[model samples]
Target: MKSIKFNRELCDFCGTCVGVCPHDAIELLESDLRITDKCTLCMNCVYICPVRALEELDEG
Candidate 1:
């Protein structure tokens, strides 16, 4: 299965991913980005992430 992966080291806490999530599956913490279970595998956050912090994880 393909899912979203968040890299805390790469994330700048910019909240850009949060805004782009159609399902509101992304959360911006003080230092972390959270991908919620509300995610429908849309991959919108993956494509819109400017810093490449979010990516498509092929867990197959």
Candidate 2:
């Protein structure tokens, strides 16, 4: 199993993740992103990242 990994370098801050999130877990600022605890690891944001920024990482 894997958890969501945020890559600040790869993120374009396009708000794509914020839009795709069903739980409204992702909040996009002018130059930063805020992910709240409401996230359920649903991967909605991860899958919608056009720049390949968001992804799930393996703990092992």
In terms of TM-score, which candidate is strongest? 1
Candidates in order have lDDT scores of 0.84, 0.83
Report the Cα lDDT for candidate 1.
Answer: 0.84
* lDDT tens digits by residue: candidate 1, 1-60: 888788899988878778878888777889887888899988878888889988889988
The deviation in Å at residue 28 for candidate 2 is: 1.1
- The per-prediction CA RMSD against the true structure, in angstroms, equals 0.9, 1.6
lDDT of 2 by residue, 1-60 (tens): 667877889888888789889999987877777778898888888888999888888887
Q: Cα lDDT for residue 32, model 1?
A: 81
Give the least accurate 10-residue stretch of model 1, judged by summed lDDT: 12-21
**Candidate 2 whole-model C-alpha lDDT, 0 to 1:** 0.83
